[model samples]
Target: MSDVIRASAAPKPVGTYPHARRVGDLLFLSGIGPRDPATNAIPGNEYFADGRVRSYDITTQTQAVFANVRAVLEASGACWEDLVDVTVYLTDMARDFKAYNAVWAEYFPDIDTAPCRTTLGITALPTPIAIELKCTAVVRADNRQD
Candidate 1:
């Protein structure tokens, strides 16, 4: 059986989907961005008056995106170490990969234990935000009932 997971501490999903879904021992997270749940704000996003993205700070946005992911993991009774894989989406890889990688290192310091990752350069995202994260984590032993 599978269960949908929602984290009130994270921004409500922009579309009709739960923050994550768990099946067996794995939790599959939806793509999460940098928007704040309480304020509906993107920390590092800068936009033009015409609603086009002018620029964004990759470091700050990466932090917020990870924070949101952390909230979802915690709500699901998991943690960073439980993460097994991740898919990263970036609107501008040439402009942002260095900053994003630096911030990512802070969370997963050791390469051996870090979750496997794949990053893609995309034209745009659902929001004006620059980056998004989708991940899979193993449910903690305590949270599992067989």
Candidate 2:
């Protein structure tokens, strides 16, 4: 009910959740999946393009998820540098953990200052997608009387 920030460039949310929400000086973003916004379809190889929902492999999926996160952060008046925490939910962590890390490294090159995070394996998510990420960021005020 307060100020809400939406990432117009990010893939649209499938349901009633904002890409991110801004409250006070913090922004809490909803989990993002891997479907490409341009097509609203998951990326697939040559054999699976008949509109039959196909789950993208870990690499492709993680990339899309990150893109979504980036879009949300930008729209919320924040950036990756402002990230304070993150949560990753996986339907099958054991199978895709390494792949997820591979993609994560590209974005978060410096782990020393990476935001506080937690990863968990869950039974299911909104879609058949493989990975999802949610994050929180702080928005520093510019004209503070300090």
Candidate 3:
């Protein structure tokens, strides 16, 4: 049976959806951004008077997003190493890819063990955050009896 999962430590989803879902041995996470759960504020981002993003630090957002992804994984009885694939969305690829890649390497250090990833440059997102991550991971049966 499949299960839906929500993580209290992660930011609340903007729409009507759980933080993640599990089916068999695989867990799928909704697109996760760098917004703090307690404050709903996007880290490293500054907004203009009109609410548009004035500037952002890709390194900060990347770190925060990774932490958010980790929260959902733990809530689903999985862990960082279980992540098998990741899809990253960036609003500005040309200017931010290097910083983002640096942060990614900090987390995934070894290429052989790192989850396969595909990054895309998108025009915009629902929020003003510059980056978002969609991830899928394996759930080891040993950590859960569900």
Pick the lDDT winner. 3
Worst 10 residues of 1 by lDDT: 137-146
For all candidates in order, the CA lDDT equals: 0.92, 0.78, 0.94
TM-scores, all candidates, are 0.94, 0.85, 0.97
Q: Model 3 over residues 1-146: C-alpha lDDT tens digits? A: 88999999999999999999999999999999999999999999988999877889999999999999999999999999999999999999999999999999989999999999999999998998989999999999897648
The digit string of per-residue lDDT tens for model 2 on 1-146 reads 54677777888998998888787788889888877878776643223477444445878888888887878887777877788998999888999899898878888889886888899999888876778888888877751112
**CA deviation > 4 Å runs, candidate 2:** 44-55, 142-146
**Count: clashes, candidate 1:** 0
| Model 3 collision count | 0
Query: What is the full ranking by lDDT, best candidate first?
Result: 3, 1, 2
Model 1 lDDT vs. the true structure?
A: 0.92
Per-residue lDDT of 24-119 in model 1, one digit per residue for the tens?
889999999999999998997788999776777889999999999999999988898899999999999999999999999989999999999999
